[model samples]
Target: MNAAEVVKSLLVQRFGIPSAHLNAETPLRSLRLDSLALEELRVLLEEQLDIDLEEVSLTPRNTVGQLVAAVDGVAA
Candidate 1:
């Protein structure tokens, strides 16, 4: 799978998010992902994608595109 797939799966499985509404522009806050969730996601990405979260802050204001971009940036 790709970055989006990884993100979507993590949200759905770990946060009980509905797949139907999960779009590239979906807001993290709308999905109820808190700071802890962001930290967990950061850890997951670090282990799975080898991306660091030192710069990427996954907050409710962050868009899916931003998250993808952050991951892409870190992975690069």
Candidate 2:
């Protein structure tokens, strides 16, 4: 899976997010991802995508599209 797919997969499987509710414009907070969950997601993304996210500034206000773009940036 690509970064977007991997991200959505992780959110759905690990975070117990309903896939139907996910979309590019959806904010992390809308998904109920708290700060701790965001950190855990960062770790999971880094592991699954094998890319460092140290430089990426993540916040619950960021959109799913934004997170995917950040991952794609690092992966690229």
- TM-score of every candidate relative to the true structure: 0.86, 0.97
For model 1, the stretches where C-alpha displacement exceeds 4 angstroms are none
RMSD of 1: 1.3
Work out how many backbone clashes candidate 1 has. Answer: 0
lDDT digits (tens) for residues 1-76 of candidate 1: 6777788788788778889978878888888878888888888877877667787767888977788788888777
37 in model 1: Cα distance from truth in Å? Answer: 1.1
Error of 2 at 7 (Å): 0.5
lDDT at 37, model 2: 96
Clashes of each: 0, 0
Clashing pairs in 2: none
Question: Which has the greatest TM-score?
Answer: 2
- What is residue 70's positional error in candidate 1, in angstroms? 0.7
Q: Mind giving the per-residue lDDT tens digits that candidate 2 earns over 1-76?
A: 9999999999999999999989999999999999899999999999998899988999999999999999999999
